[model samples]
Target: MVVEIVQDKEIWDRFIDESPYGLIFHKWEFLKIVEKYSGYTLYPCGVFRGDILIGVFPLYYKRNMAFKAIFSPPPQSGIPYLGFVMSSEYNGLKQDKKEVFLNQVVDEINDYIELASPNYVSISTVSNFIDIRPFKWNNFEVVPNYNYVIHLDEDLDSIWNGFKKNLRKQLSRPEILDLRLVPSEDMSLFYNLAKQRYEEQGLTYPIYSIEYLEDLFRVYPNHLRLYYLYYGDDLLGSITTQEYKRYILWMGNTRIPDNIFGNEYIIWHLIQKAKEEGYLNFEITGANKKNLCQFKTKFNPTLEICYNVCRKDTLGKLAETTYQKFVRKAG
Candidate 1:
């Protein structure tokens, strides 16, 4: 087996499109956007056995005066998870064979890591890529995060019946029903609301700039959806969703107060839209946050755990500890 940098976009994206574990986050175009907006250098690597391509891993390199780091699906890019995109051949392998193949991939990754010699390396694997034991064995720190996924293949009535009573009540409210669900191009409004939300929580706003969002919309128009809840001329809230293989409720911002319950209305509308669109799953990403978990649980979605793997050198470890301490104190 040999691993080398893949420069051909068609080859890279073909593997991603064919893999069951692939996501929109792993697409070549998305990585270009990430690199362009975040100003990070991208390394697109491919592993081949003999002459056949078997795996692809994309890494972003970041450097500062203090440290150098590499991330797979880097932070603040609206990407939930991305690590390795393996071929379908690996997917069908028996457990023992799968382990052997995975180890080979890890070996290649380790070789690249040694050559790059970054202070830190972090990778978040897709939801379906659950065989992260190889990474664990390699001394990477593993952190578990939760996401809520509603299986949308079932009958709509059955799905609706699964919602909590209060959620159902909120969805049924006449005021909510009267609000129009309209497609929106107002990213500035979305950014302002998101900024206000972060300020309200006394935390720094983490979203990318309006320019970045606009560029993302331009690049992946079919994959992205932006919707707003409006009562005639008054905008109440906005929700952004992405459709890859499944529907994902990526981010949302609301101008309406809690008592107004505009969020419930907008979410319900999106859920129904997902059902109509024949998506097999609707994911409410990042159910790890306390308040978010509570709110998303009202829909009776299944809990899915995703993994973030990190490996750091001495300096990187110290930096991580200091960052954690600061966050704890701030919280």
Candidate 2:
């Protein structure tokens, strides 16, 4: 098998869409947007066996004089995960065959990484990507991340019954249940609200700007959306949901001290809506945040584990530590 950088958008996107392990963040257009906004070059690499494709990896590269870095999904892109994903056929292979196929793919990826020789490297894989052994074998530090995913196969009553009592009590109100999480192309509003929330919490904003979001929404209308709830003319809350095989609560809905039920109502509504639309799962992204976990746990979704693989040389380690210790604080 050979690893080659894929230039055709259609071919690259088709593979990602077909893979059960692929995510919206792995799509070609999404990567292009991130590349444009983050000022990093994106390399959509595919592992091919004969004439067939077996694996896909969306990698980002950046250089600053002698220092360089590589990332999948890159940092501060508001993307939870983006690493290599195998083709659908791999999922059907026997256990031994799966290991062999994965080994070959990782070998090629490692070769490419060696050729690039970045000072630092990071790759965060999707929750379903459980076989990260190849990366571990290559001496990449493995870190586990968490997410909450609700299997939509269960009945509405059964799913609701699983929720924490406090969450259920908040959503049980007739007024809250009757309110709708309306979808719209209001990019400015979503960005402003999200940006303000981040500032209020003393955290840096995630996405680049409204233009970045607007482009994504326009390009992938079917995949991403902005949904908001209203109390008369006042905007109670808003959320961005990502739709593919799984309906994901992608972003927004930061706590509004006054509108306590806004987020819970939206989440419950999305769960029922996703199930009704025949989606297999509903993922509440970023379950690692301690403060956010309190809200996410109330829904009682299954805790899912993902992995982040990283490697840095001595110089890279020193630079990162220095930045964390002094430069970041100085800024």
Candidate 3:
């Protein structure tokens, strides 16, 4: 297989859409938006066997006078995973055949890494991409990350019953309080809430723009939305969800009046909505963080693991250590 920058948007997107490992994060439109906001150059790379594309890996490269960095989802993009995804047929192949193709793809990726020689590299592989040995073979370090998932195959009642006792009580609070979960295209309200709350906490949130979200909403109306929690006419809080193969609690699930139990109310309704729409799973991302794991674990959902494969050179190691010290001290 030969690896090169894929230029045809239609071919690349079609392959990604059909791939079992593909997520909305793998799409060209999403990557373009991420590139603009992250200030990284988008590289939609492809591995092709003769005339057919076998895999696509969309990466973001950042270059400056001080350093060069590479990321799949990019830092601060709020994307949980964005790595290479294989073709649909790749999944049906026998184990040996699959590894052969995967090995070649990883080799090509390594070749590119060698040529570019970025100081640091990180790739958060999608949940379905289980084989990390190929990447590990190339000297990448594997770090485990977690995401909380609610399997929605069963009926809503069964799903509700599976929640912890305290969670059931929390879910019931909304019914008595007269709060409404209204779905809307109001990206402005959600963005304002997120931006203001982060500022109030003395945190900087420059990862996304209103235009970036607006563009995403415009491009994928069916796949992304904002659900506002309203007490009569007053907005208590809001959340954003992304619907692809799985329904993802994408952002804005916090900074609400904690006393009202608004997060529990809105997210419960969203889970029901996702199940009704035939989604097989609801993913409450950010479980890797201690603060989030405590709150998200209340639902009694299954904990899932994903790999963050990373590598750094000598200078990169020093830079990363310095960056980590600054972050830890600040926290």
Give the per-residue Cα lDDT of candidate 2 at 7: 90
lDDT of 3 by residue, 204-239 (tens): 554468888888878888888778888777778888
Write one digit per residue (lDDT tens) for candidate 2, span 112-231: 988988999989998867889999899899999999999988899999999999788888766675566788998888888887777776565767778988998999998898888875
What's the lDDT for candidate 3? 0.82
Best by lDDT: 2
TM-scores for every predicted model: 0.92, 0.93, 0.91
Query: Which scores greater on TM-score, model 1 or model 3?
Result: 1
Best by TM-score: 2
What number of clashing residue pairs does each candidate have, in the order they appear?
0, 0, 0
Ranking by lDDT: 2, 1, 3
- lDDT by residue (182-285, candidate 1, tens digit) is 98777888888887787787665665678888888778888887887887678787888888788998888777866667877777778888899888988888
Tell me, what's the RMSD of every candidate? 2.4, 2.1, 2.4
